[model samples]
Target: MTSDRDWTGRVGDIWATEWRRTDRSFERLAPVLNAAIVAAAGPQAGTIVDIGCGAGATSLASAQALPDGQVIGIDLSPKLIAVANHRAGSLGNVAFRCADVASAVGMHAPVDLYVSRHGVMFFADPVAAFAQLDEAAAPGAALVFSCFAERAANRWAVETVAGADDASGPTGAMTAPGPLPLPIRPMSRRC
Candidate 1:
């Protein structure tokens, strides 16, 4: 990993080895998550752009559920993108982009939905990032993302299940003050 690039881009190198080896634990959670999210979004969601779509789990689910719509998973990690592509194969109307989401919207055309799985939260300039995504989404586009209410929740879960290295920080909130003066919907509701 380059010292200059952001950690989000290097997530695969940092976590892939560990997660890829994970038995069926993640697989078991897939169906449970897919049903809840797909049902909540309803059946009308059009094209979806899955941001930070590690391994394409959510992306695949969206595509499977919305056969009429397309899904494009975007992430900064080449390895993760590759894995996602390899696993999904030619499921018509599905793509993956290995570019930084912060600047990628400018290069790509807009879509009907901007989805993310624990993505879109780690940006140095969220205002710019949100604006980019805001512009990229089609009018009335819905964003379906499943993120940790707390970043350390997953880590803590793993720690509880399997002993962790001694060097762990206390559970803390991971957020930044907004750059724009406008009110954000606290990620609980659409902005």
Candidate 2:
């Protein structure tokens, strides 16, 4: 599993340095996820939170789409947050912070929407983490996120990680906490 320690240190630094490549890796999915987020947020979303936002791409995109809304990107890595901040440049609507979203979400209470791009899987206790998010959300708030399918279904991920020497080796499948092998059931609930 990719622990918070790994993200806060080496993994985060590597991701920050390779953010361009990382973002490019998600080129196909970003548009779809962003569209879903925008659709779910609706026109009057006052505040949006991007959970585990790496370089703030989604946050920036959402901010651009909803000029009147506030977008905040939260991540566990200082390096990633720094990269996000740098990329934000003069975008006044979006901001990035380095912190654990599970614990810090309350500070941004009444969030109108929450979004993540392959980001929510890293939490040690996903239920608790999402509960925290639920606690912070405004009534009728929506959440949208994307995660890997299954290992057997993702040939690229399987092939890429086939040569791993151990479970902790370097590969998208190997490093991520809940990789392809874990089947994630779709969940929907209305509070």
Candidate 3:
């Protein structure tokens, strides 16, 4: 049986080995991530927690926005966290920790804002991890994260898949880029 610790360790090992290469791509997304966080949290986001903060670029950017506030960048990979800390040098309000957020409930201060850029998807238990993050935040705190809906919704991915498969990539179900009716409905009750 695969224990939780074992799984977490394995994940950390994989990222530790791949962080150098992955960091290059992740660096490019910092601007977009900043935009998303700014839009969601608005100006003056106090006490932010960045989940799955790979190399802490988004975390550093967020800390810059909140000069008086604090930001904690959390990740499972020790190597990535170390890099983040090294990069954080003279930044007093910014800090990085190697931890599994899903299991670190009540370990953080109540945050005014929470940001995750392409980071929330790696959770072993996404619902539980989100619940933990929610618990760690103050009431009325804003949660902001971006994720691509599906392969069909992403233009670059669609092009890549089409080219890879001789121009034949998932017919019929793929919705073209435009307004498409969704089956979603407003929730009448709060969970």
Candidate 4:
């Protein structure tokens, strides 16, 4: 499991540095995910939160898609937040913040939509984290996110980290909690 400390420090720095590559890696999935988010949010969505927004690509895209809506990208990495802010430039509808979305969601209360791209996988306690988001959301708020299919399904990811290993052991496998083939199962239900 990736800890908050990792995101706040070395891991975060690496992501910030390699954000361009990371974004490119998600090129195929991003459009599909963004389209789902836009469809869920609709044009009248007043406020949207991009949970675990790394370099703000999703946030920027959503902001551009919904010019009348406000989009806030929240992440645990200061470096990532910096990159996001820099990329945002003069976009009036989007903003980035370095903070835990579980705790910070309340700050942007009544959010009309919540979106992520393989971001929620790192949460230590996803159930509790999502509960908080539920609490802070508007009556008809929509949540949309995407996570990796599985170790086998995503050959690109496995190949990319073929030799990498963390404290868990030397399997070169990701240690995120939940189902092996599909992590989305936990959050699949409608409220």
User: lDDT scores for all predictions?
Assistant: 0.64, 0.85, 0.68, 0.85
lDDT, candidate 2, 64-132, per-residue tens: 988989999999999999999999999999989899998988999889999899888788777788899
lDDT of 1: 0.64
Per-residue CA lDDT of candidate 4, range 10-83, in tens?
98999999999999998999899989988998769799999999989999999999899999999999999999
Per-residue lDDT of model 1, residues 61-118, tens digit only: 8888888777888877777777888878879868888877757765555566777755
Cα lDDT tens digits for candidate 3, 51-112: 77867778888888767768888877777787789878999989888888666635775777
Q: Work out candidate 2's RMSD over C-alphas.
A: 3.5
Q: How close is every model to the real structure, measured as TM-score?
A: 0.70, 0.89, 0.70, 0.85
**Compared to the true structure, candidate 3 yields what TM-score?**
0.70
Better of 1 and 3 by lDDT: 3
Rank order by lDDT, top first?
2, 4, 3, 1
Residue 67 alpha-carbon offset, candidate 2, angstroms: 0.7
RMSD of each: 5.6, 3.5, 6.5, 3.8
Comparison by lDDT, 1 against 2, better one: 2
- As for TM-score, the candidate ahead, 1 or 4, is 4
TM-score ranking, best first: 2, 4, 3, 1
